[model samples]
Structure formats: structure tokens, C-alpha cells
Target: MKIGIIGGGSIGLLFSCYLSENHQVTLYCRTINQVNMINQCGITLQKKDSSILSNIHAKLSTERVADELVLVTVKQYHLPELLPILDKIPQHIPLLFLQNGMGHLDYLQKMKHDNILLGVVEHGALKISLSTVKHTGFGTTRVAAYKGDMQKLMAIKNTLQMSNFPFEIEANYNEMLIRKLVVNAAINPLTALLRIKNGDLLSNNYYFELLKEVFQEIIQVLCLQELEDTYFASIVSICQSTSNNYSSMLKDILEHRQTEIEGIVGVLRNKAEIQKQSVPFLQFLYTSIKGMEYKRWDE
Candidate 1:
């Protein structure tokens, strides 16, 4: 299997290293330095107990993406610029998009790919360097086809799944993404603002109160009222599992990078307005994270 990964961020590098073990993997990087470094040094995955390094092909983003499968791991904001390049890939090849929120869903409608898959990466990964990623949490990659054959998704899962790194195919893409969106909406902004690890939200009652408030608004906007309990439990489980890890949003704030607030919270607020639902908590989080991101420009 030939797999090409777009973006050299933590999630991209993590998948490149793990998938390269079984497939002919090529990592497409935006910067020449990362491509050069990955080609010379290989990609490394640092686990709690051990570190595994895998050698794989590296290429610049400008090159053609011809592969059995391609994973777009770049942040949602970067997707607009990337879509033109991805348009060149043969539509028959499956492309899996792993983004934080539902904003990327709109992008899929325009793609010509016959087999477009949507997925949420539950595992927590932190980039240590250009060629290294730390696996901060262990979780499954749940995938659902936006518009494709189920057998194709299952086949891709079977080809890509590993004992240590697992992949599961879901029946409903919207449900899978909604669950992840709830997790991100509740956990990310709280952690980013408080400058605390995810676990802190669960440990502190006051923080937990605010978390519930935010989660309720998101659920309301998405109209997941029936599964509120189930979704909240999933959020708690994720925070508990990735206790020590800083969320991608929190990391973005700390590192002075733009967070995916627009994709995650921003999208929710838009939905709220359309539905004529009141979501003060979501509105607050959307603006708050935006304010934090705006500071980057001042610095």
C-alpha cells in the first residue's frame, strides 16, 4: 500500500511513522527543511515505554500526491490553500480528513473524490520537532465515509490497522464527528484559558461546572439532546485518558500559534444563529479563544 500524508504536524508525522511500518509511506511537507530532515533522520514516535523510528519517503507539497490513500492532517485553516493541490489527485483514490471540528465538512462537498472519508483522531500527539512526535494518549482512529463504499473503508481499515495503532470504521460520519466536536468544544477552550491540562477540568468542581455549561450549549446547537449523557461521558473519558497532555488549542495558545477556534467553536456559533438558539457559553468561548489567538499578531 502506498500512503501519502499531507502536513508534517504531530498527527501527520505520527501516522507517517506508524503507517510506514507496513506501507510505502510518503510524507508531504510544506517546508523544505522538514522534508530534508525527515528524509535524512526518519520519523520517530516516542511512546511512554519506547521510541520507534521508521524510514519513509518525503516530498514537497508541490509534488503530485499519487498514492493508494492520503490523509490530510493539516489544520482546518490550512485546508483552503491545500484543496487546489489535492484537487489534482485522481478522484478514485480515497482521501481521509482528520480535523478538529465540522468546518472541513463544507470542503468535502466540492471534492471530486469518489471515496472521501471523515475521521477524528482520539489519540493525543505532540510534536517534539520536525521529525519527532510524542504519543501522549492511546485512542482509536474512527473513520466514516462521507460518500463512498463501505467495503472500501473497511478494506482501508484492515490494511491500515495495527495492534498498537488501531482504526475503527463507523456507520455514521456525522455522529462520529459530532462526538469529537463536543469533546473539543468543551475541553479545549477551558484548558486553553486556564492554562491547565485536560484532567484539571474534571478534577476541579468549579471548572467542571463551566465545562458542563459549554458542553450543553454545543449539544443544543447540534441538537444532540438524546445523546447528551453519552457524549458527555465520552468527553470525560478523553480528558481522563489524556490527563497530562495539553490540548492542541492550549498548545496553540502557549506556542503563540492560531488555534482552530473558527472551525470548532466558530462553526457552532454559526449553527446556533441559524437554529435561533441561544448559546452564550459557546459565544464566550468563541470570542475568548479568538482574543487569545489575536494576541499572536500583537506579539
Candidate 2:
């Protein structure tokens, strides 16, 4: 199978390394420096005790995408710019979007592709360098057909699944993405602001209180009243599972890069406004994170 990963970030690099083991991978990088480094040195996947380098074809994202399957691994904010590039792909080729937040669903609805699949990456991946990624947590990639055939998705899943990296088929895309949205909205902002590891949200009693408070606001906005326990429990489980892992948002703040707060929390904020509800917690988080982002830019 030939796979075109459309982002050279942590998720893109991690997926490229693992998927390249059993398939042909063409990684689309945002910069020429990364492309040159990857094409010259190959991509390095770092684990607890082992590191392996896998050779993958690298190119700028401006190039055409002519692969069997394309994984859109860019951040949600970056998706708008890539939509034009995505439109150029042959309609028969399947496109899988692996991004946080339910906001991308809006863009997905406007797309013209024949087979569009959605996925949530649970693996904790951190890009160590332009050509190296650290797999901090081993987790499944849940995939569902948004407007495609199930057999096609299943076939893609079967070919992509490996021992180290796994993929699961989901029946409902909405249910799949919203569960991830709940996790992102509840955990990411608090951790970024508090400057703590994922586990700290659970370990510290006071932080745990704020976590619950934020979770309540998110569920209320999304109207997940009946399954609140199920979703909340999943957040706690994720925190424990990736206890030491720093969230992507926190890493973005620390690295002075733009975070995906708008894609994740901003979606909820918009929904809250539409529903005419008050979400002080989400509002504060959205503003505070944006402030930090501006501070970095202004400095």
C-alpha cells in the first residue's frame, strides 16, 4: 500500500515510521529543511529502549498527492490551506483526517471526495527533531467512514494495522470524534495553563477539581448528559494512561508555537454561543491560551 502523510509533525512522522514498515510512505513536509533532512537521513522512531530509522520519500506539501491513501495529519488550523491541495487528489483515492476536535467535521462536510474517513490518534507522539519522533504512549487509531464505504475503510485498516501500531474500525464518526473532543477540551487547556503533566490533572486534588469543572462545562455544551460518566471516566483513564506525557497544547506553548485551542475548545465556545449558554471556563481557557500565543508572537 502506498500512503501519503500530509503533515511532517509528530503524528505524521510517527505514522510514517510505523506505516513505512509494511507499506510505501511519502511524507509531505511543510519545510524544505525537513524534507532534505528526512530524504538524506531517513526518519528515526524512538522508543523506550530502541530506535529505528525508516526511509520514506519526502516532498514539500505543494507537490501533488498521488498515493493509494492519504492521511491528513496537519493540525486543525492548518487544514483550511490544505483543502485546495486535497481537492486536487483523484476522487477515487481515500483521504483520512487524523486531527483533534470536532470542528474539522464542518470542513469535511464541504469536501468533494468520494471516500472520506475520520480518525482519532490516541498514541502519545512527540517530535524530537525534524526527522525523529518519540512514541511516548502506545494507543490505537480509531477510524470511521464519514462518507465512504465501510469495506473500503476495513480494507485500509487491515493493511495499515501492525503489531506496534494498531487501527480499529468505528461505526459512527460523530460518536468517535466527540469522545476525543471531550478528552481534548477537558484536559488540554488546564494542563497547558498549569504547566503540568497529564497525570498531574488527576494526582493533584485541586487540579482534579478544575478538571471536573471544565469537564462539566464541556459536556453541558455538547449535551452529553446521559453518558457523562462514561466520557468523564475516559478522560481520567487517558490521563492515567499517558501520565507522564505532556499534551500537544502544552508542548506548543512551551515551544512558542501556535496551539490548536481554536480547533478544540473554540468549537465548543462557538457551539455554546449558538446554544445561548454560558461557558465561563471554556471562555477563560480560550482567551488565556490565545493571550499566551499572542505574547509569544509579540515578544
Candidate 3:
């Protein structure tokens, strides 16, 4: 299959590394430096055990855009900009949204990209350099087609599994997405605020309390999505699974870059307002981290 990855970050390039072995992989990069590096030397994938794999195609922009599948891994704020770029790509080609929070589907809905599939992946990777990425943890991916296209979803699932990637197809896409959002909402912000790794939250009891408060608000917001069953236990399970890793939010803050507070916390706040539900904890988190993001600009 010819695959195109829309984001040039860790997640995009890491998948390209392994999947490129059997398929034609093209990466869409925004920067000239990344484009130059990939064109010159390809991507380098470093394993947890220090093994290295390199050489994968990375394109500067979308040119000759015929792809059987496309993975949109751009940040939520970039969605508006990214969608129009995807217009050149074929309509029937399946697009998988690999983002960290809720409301991605709603935006896609407005743009009318109904061929979209939502997938929640737990695998973690960090870009150490421009074209170098380190795979930190291996976690299962759960995906489903939101537009009632079961056959195509199954085909994508089969290919992912055959590629030796850990993945599964959830019978219910909405429920699965809400569950993933809940976990991300619970863990990401506190880690970013405290400037700590995922596991470090376990070391600080105060942070655990903060996590519980956020998880409760997430649970409250998820109730609007008919996901009352996504409880604290589910959030705890994700915390334990990704214990040793630094969250994407923390990575953003440490690198002095913009964080996905909107995707992670702002979405929760938006849901609460739309549903006329009171989510004080979520509102507070949204305001706090947003302040941090701006404050970093002064620093």
C-alpha cells in the first residue's frame, strides 16, 4: 500500500520507519530542514535497545498525492490548515486521525471528510533530532471506522497487524475515542504543569489528587458522550501503562513549544459548556495551562 503521513513529528516518522519496509511511505513535512534531511539520509528509528533502522522517504509538501491510506497526525490546531492540503489527495482513500484528544472527529465532520477513521494508539515515540526518533514504549492501538465502513476498517486493521504492529479494532468508535480522551485528559496536563514524566505523577501524592480531580471532570464531560463507564480505574490503567514515558504535553513545554492544551483540556471545557454541564476542574485546568503556554513566550 502507498501510505502518506501528514505530520513529520515522532509519531509520523516512527510509523514510516517500520511500515516503509513493505510499503511505499511518503511523509509530508512543513520545514525545509526536515525535508532536506529525509531527502538526503531518510529517517532513523532508534529502538529501546539502541538498535537503529534508517532510510525512509519524506516529502516537503504534497506533490503527486496518490496514496491508498493517509495518517493525519498533525496537532489539533493544525487541523484547519491540514484539511485543505488534503483536498488534493483522493477522496476515497482512507484517512486515520492519530491525535490526542476529543473533537477531532467533529472538525472533520464539518469539513465533510467522511472517509475518516479514528484510532487511539498507546505506542510512544520521541524525536530526539530532526530526523531521528526513539521508540519508547510499545502499546496496542484500537481503531474503528466512524462512517459505517466496516470492510475498509477491517482491511486497515489486517494490514496493521500483519505489519507486526500491536493494534485492535474497537467495535464502537465513539466509546473508544471518549475513553482515550479521558485518559489523556487525566494525565497529560498535570505532567505538563509539574514538569514531570508520566511515572513521576505516581511519586507525588498531591499530583495524584490533582489527577483525580481532572479525571472526575473528564468523566463528567464524557457522560455527555454516553461514556459513563469510563471511570477512574480506566484512567489509572493508562497511567500505569505509560508510566515511564514523558507525556507529549511535557515534551512540548520542555522544548518551549506550544502544547495541545486545547485538544486535551479545552475540548473538555467546550463539551461541558455545550452540554450545560458544570466542570469546574476542567475549566481551571484549561485556564492554568493556557497561561503557562503564554508565559513561556515571555521566558
For candidate 1, write residues 1-299 as lDDT tens digits.
99999999999999998898899999999999999999999988999999988897899988999898999999999999998899999979999999989999998899998999998997879999999999887889999989999999999999999999999999999989888888888999889988999999999999999999998888889988999999999899888888887888999999999999999998999998989999998888788889988888788
Tell me, by lDDT, which candidate is best. 2
Which of candidates 1 and 2 is the stronger one according to lDDT? 2
**Candidate 3, 282: how far from true, in Å?**
1.7
Q: How many angstroms is residue 127 displaced in model 1 relative to the true structure, after the best TM-score fit?
A: 0.5
Model 1 lDDT, residue 203, Cα: 93
Model 1, residue 37: what's the lDDT?
Answer: 96
Local accuracy of candidate 2 as per-residue lDDT tens digits, 149-229 = 889999999999897798999999999999999999999999999999999999999999999999999999999999999
**Colliding residue pairs in candidate 3:** none
Q: Give the candidate number with the greatest TM-score.
A: 2
Q: What CA root-mean-square deviation does each model show from the true structure?
A: 1.1, 0.9, 2.2
- In order, the Cα lDDT scores of the candidates are 0.91, 0.94, 0.78
Model 1: residues with Cα > 4 Å off, grouped in runs: none
Summed over model 2, clashes come to 0
* Candidates 1 and 3 compared by lDDT, better number: 1
Candidate 3 per-residue lDDT, tens place, 1-299, comes to 88888888888878888778778888888898898898898788888667566677777665555679988877787887776677767678888888878767667775455477888877888887778888887777788787748888888878866445666888988778777777778788888877777876666798888886777677776664354454666667667777777888888888888888888788888878999989887777778788888988888
Better of 2 and 3 by TM-score: 2
**Clash count, one per candidate:** 0, 0, 0
Ranking by lDDT: 2, 1, 3
